[model samples]
Target: MRTRITTIAATVMLTAAAIAHAGNVGISAGDYYSPTLATTLTAQGNSVHAVGWYNDNVLSTYDVYIQDGSSFADAAALDRFVYHGGTLIQLPWSFTNIAYTADTTVFSRRRRGTLEQLNPGIDVIAPDDWLLAGVTLPEAGTQTIGREIGNRFADGATPVLEWEDGTALLGYRRYGAGLVVGFDVHLVTADASPLSADWSNRIIGNAISPVPELSTWAMLATGATMLLLRRRRPD
Candidate 1:
């Protein structure tokens, strides 16, 4: 009986550990920008995957998905994944890469005076949101020049971050069972100084490696209670 209790405790501890570890961050195959991303996230202890193929069940397979490619397999698949509770971080021009064939949804776009591009300033609309941890945007709410990158969301999308002209730099939209956090591509700063480069890496890291939920704690507690009860049982 003592051995059985020890085994149960070990099993529960393992489950608790797995729950705390969280999901893997999927970086698109040809995204050229993900190497730094992987490095930053890994340093923070997140399992990052370079995704080569995305078919059925693909969206649900990952905890977070960054639209890093110039092309994605299916928009409907992505939509389903988000509403189903998957987190998404996107880059600029990702709209051009994805063919939203499932519906007539229109993604918006605008150029800031045709010259202010690349490395645009980011905003933090939801300060308390878990996805925003270790992230800040000083250029928010101001006309900041970027790497000429530009993309906007459809009419119904909620703005999490916006450009100087009020375009979405980062935004949130609830689809089915998930939430989508859209990001402009140029905002990705990686492999630079600790103060600046690859800030998004922490964003992805924090997303895939979140704190233990109540259910996770409950599971751990349940196991402990079981062991305690077993120890006190009249043998």
Candidate 2:
């Protein structure tokens, strides 16, 4: 009887650990200038969430759009800052003027923009709703910008954006659950020099490393094992 209990507890602990470590997702972009961009993301489970941002002196004067899988026409508009699973966020001129200054330790001169729900039937979260911090360019010759997004529902999940010498911009997006995340960065800038640097490196450095679900399962297993060992010991 004691041996049986010990084995059962070990198994249970391992399973729990795997589950806890299994759900992690992340994405990032480095130095780019273009009308649009895209990346592939991986999610462990059936359900996952995401967020994004852009850095430029151009206020909210442009439109941002997202799509899942293939087909941009079917892209969902992410105008609001709400979590809606696979829905995309789109920005229009109405969502302009949402700018702020980037600080080392704090966010200054922050501005809030409204995110509208484009497809009511689909569940999607808007950038405005998830935007934790951002920075704006001062209309000077050039300005480096930064932006960040995070998974409000998950633990230890956040993304960061950094602009280098007003010529380049880097961004990272992270989420919980070993989920693969894909995204694109659209730069509506006149200059193309910013997008030269290899973005993959920046992303790898900024984005959080994915944690395997199996790890969580292992923890659970360990816990169970501990209980089992305790029970198996001669009383």
Candidate 3:
């Protein structure tokens, strides 16, 4: 009887761990892949795969898909995937404007040195959002100009993180039944500073990690209580 109780307890713990870490993520830049990003996601406890192309079948396999600034021909397939409840994370490349609603000239300026581009300070526009939870904005990264989003955002989109000057660094919105998240910095690069990399990793981890629902917590509590009760009942 004691052995059976122990087995149940072990099973409960394993189940909880699985629920907390189980997320299938795909990292892609169309034909270009980021090994650093893949390894980072793997370290964060998610099953990460490299996506070579964008299609309905490929997109459907992942709960979260990351587009690391590559241009692809199959835009419609990606749209359908998001429409049918697949989360998409976009990391725009150098000299491109993403998620901006208005003027693009603010991000078009060229930088001559790393010092001119790497800005570590960030402005938190959405402090209460779960994506920014437990993360300090000013410490997030040394995001470069033209590598992050501009201040203006599309309708219904929420900017969670931004440059000190108010240009968006990260943002998200709901599209159909899924979510679309945009990160302006190049997180996949090995060139980022240690502090910046740590912060970027933390945010990406938050994006891919699953939070257990209230019902799941209740069920686990009930099961554990029953097990304890059985173990203590005049045995």
Give the Cα error of residue 3 in candidate 1, in Å: 30
The lDDT of each candidate is: 0.58, 0.27, 0.61
Best by lDDT: 3
Position 234, candidate 1: lDDT:
100
Give the C-alpha lDDT of model 2.
0.27
Q: Candidate 1, residues 1-235: lDDT per residue as tens digits?
A: 5676666766777776677555677777665455656666667767678876786477667888777646455677776666677777665455556654322223465443232334345555666665566665454423323332445666766665555544565555566665566655343223332212444555555556655555766777677767678778897
- Tens-digit lDDT track for model 2 on 8-49? 866675554454332232111221221222332222131222
Q: Sort the predicted structures by TM-score, highest score first.
A: 3, 1, 2
Residues 1-235 of candidate 3: C-alpha lDDT, one tens digit per residue: 5576566767886788575553899877433335777776777667888776667888898888877654442556656777788777766552242322222112333222122255657777877776765675535344443354343455567778776765666777776787777666653335642223666667777767645555776687668769777768894
* TM-scores, all models, native as reference: 0.62, 0.25, 0.66
Worst 10 residues of 2 by lDDT: 100-109
For candidate 3, the per-residue lDDT at 27 reads 79
